[model samples]
Target: MDQITNDLKKSLESNDAYCLSELSTLFSDRALTDGPHINEDLNTCYGGVLNELHNVACLNGNEVWTSGDKDNIYLYNLKGDILKDFQTSSTSCIQDIAVTQSGQLLYTDDNNRSVNIVSNTQIDTLIKLNEWIPHGVCIASSGDFLVAMTSVDWDHTNVVRYSGSTEKYSIQWDDQGQPLFPAGYTTKYLKENKNLDICLADPDARAVMVVSAARKLRFKYTGSSSSITLKEPFYPSGITTDNYSKILIADMCNQIIHIVDKNSHFLRYIKNYNLRSPRGLRVDSKDNLFVAECYTGRIKKIQFYR
Candidate 1:
């Protein structure tokens, strides 16, 4: 508590990018970290969710698919039963997951060595990393493939799109020959909707940068603080989209999740649970919430209210 805050303060003062990145994300979720489901008391303030998970994904049904630290991939029913525990390759760790538009399976690892394409055939590929480490992957509404990329050490991040047989690496915004995030940020998610590839950028600059699927910069949200200054953390991660065309971001460091409308208005928040660290938010066809609990290593399901 106090120790973590003080440590964070010191780290921020020195401009340690990783710690700063962590802090920025922490404050963004502070709005809900103290909800009853999170702290059990309004006065007892804290940040983050109540669970842990290595990775998480939502299926067409209310079910959730997750990987625990125990070297097992489990498909869970709503009642939390192990419906299936399909053993993956011994050393293949699950990092990111994306389902097809028709509800099939696709996932990528941090190493970018493989992309799992699921079916009865269970096809998968370890895409050789020629330039960057893979952070997130998604199938756009139009069925294009988009991969979120970053330097191995998290120095630079970008979104690259593959449509049909043509591939384009994005510059600043999504156009070719444009400069990607100049500050060298790590982009965690690419969400496609309404024929647009939406990039949710989580840069070390402590803000959310939005860009088109083609990698064009749309807008940037550094996030606002209720306090007088922007000292609160704002490392935005685990991005998902809602029905009304809003974006949901997991403010990891603060233990809260924020919902921003398509117009980017700060909407209501979900602070009902204590999160150690939440990342990789996913909304199913029904708009149910699923998140990867980074620190404790468990994936917990969240019910959404309109």
Candidate 2:
């Protein structure tokens, strides 16, 4: 343990990019805690400004960016006040939205087949694909962009990694040469776990698929039948991970959030919060979860961990 700490300190002092997965492994014992339990509700931001809220991205500790079936994105505070409203470069609605570590907003425009970044009200096109339509996007700890895309014909789907508009690689198949994600125009949301695992919520498959940093198949969580409160089919819509590497998935059909460990072990279900069609999820630095309700058009703030 001392040696590992010394090595991490040296890497930090040198200002070089370090592997978060290695750190997570080294500190797994210390990071592990009791099962997560929900605390009192913190706040709720009314998203009625949008016709139907679909996605929510944490901008900072006190602010979040929201989008619906429109080309505009609104930034709101915990008090439900709009801080700023920005429109996408294309007239199409935003498929998904994510915030970078540096606080910049990134969104996907499937209609234009482009990925754009919003900085100080100026929208710049970062990536433009020919046959693939961008659906969901998230920023990895390595400063790379992981985008979920569907083919032009909507028959195939995959996740691609990009570094400043340059294609790095893609994760589409498993070791057995089978497609990892379901096909068609289904909504697929993804995020990078603290262990450097790519976690995706696929509603069509009704499962949460996770892949290691090496792009190997880790596990697939297809909802638990033991839970009496969870509805019949598990419909995972949005996904996010906390500092402890716990995967939080939004179950759209059940109207609850499912919590799982890094190894795909079912932890618990958050069903007490008056969740109504929880579609998108985002966790702040403090593990505060922000859930976007599709029908209610509201963003609820939840504290599920100490």
Report the number of the highest-lDDT candidate: 2
By TM-score, how accurate is candidate 1?
0.70
Q: Worst lDDT window (10 residues) for model 1?
A: 38-47
Candidate 2 residue-wise lDDT at 3: 78
Candidate 1 residue-wise lDDT, 168-275, digit = tens: 444334346545564453446656543243646463666666664334455776667453232357777667775445677887777667777655567666664665
- lDDT (10s digit) by residue, model 2, range 1-306: 647655664676422243345565665433332444433223333345356788999888788898887778889887777889976766777899999877899999988999999898989999989999998899987788999988988888899999988998899998899998888678789998877788988887888888887777789999885756464688888899887788999988888888888888887788855778888898998787888888778777777764
State the displacement of the C-alpha of residue 126, model 1, in Å, after optimal TM-score superposition. Answer: 7.0
Tell how far residue 17 is off in model 1, in angstroms: 37
Q: CA lDDT of 77 in candidate 1?
A: 65
Q: How does candidate 2 score on lDDT?
A: 0.81
lDDT of each: 0.57, 0.81
TM-score, cand. 2 vs. native: 0.87
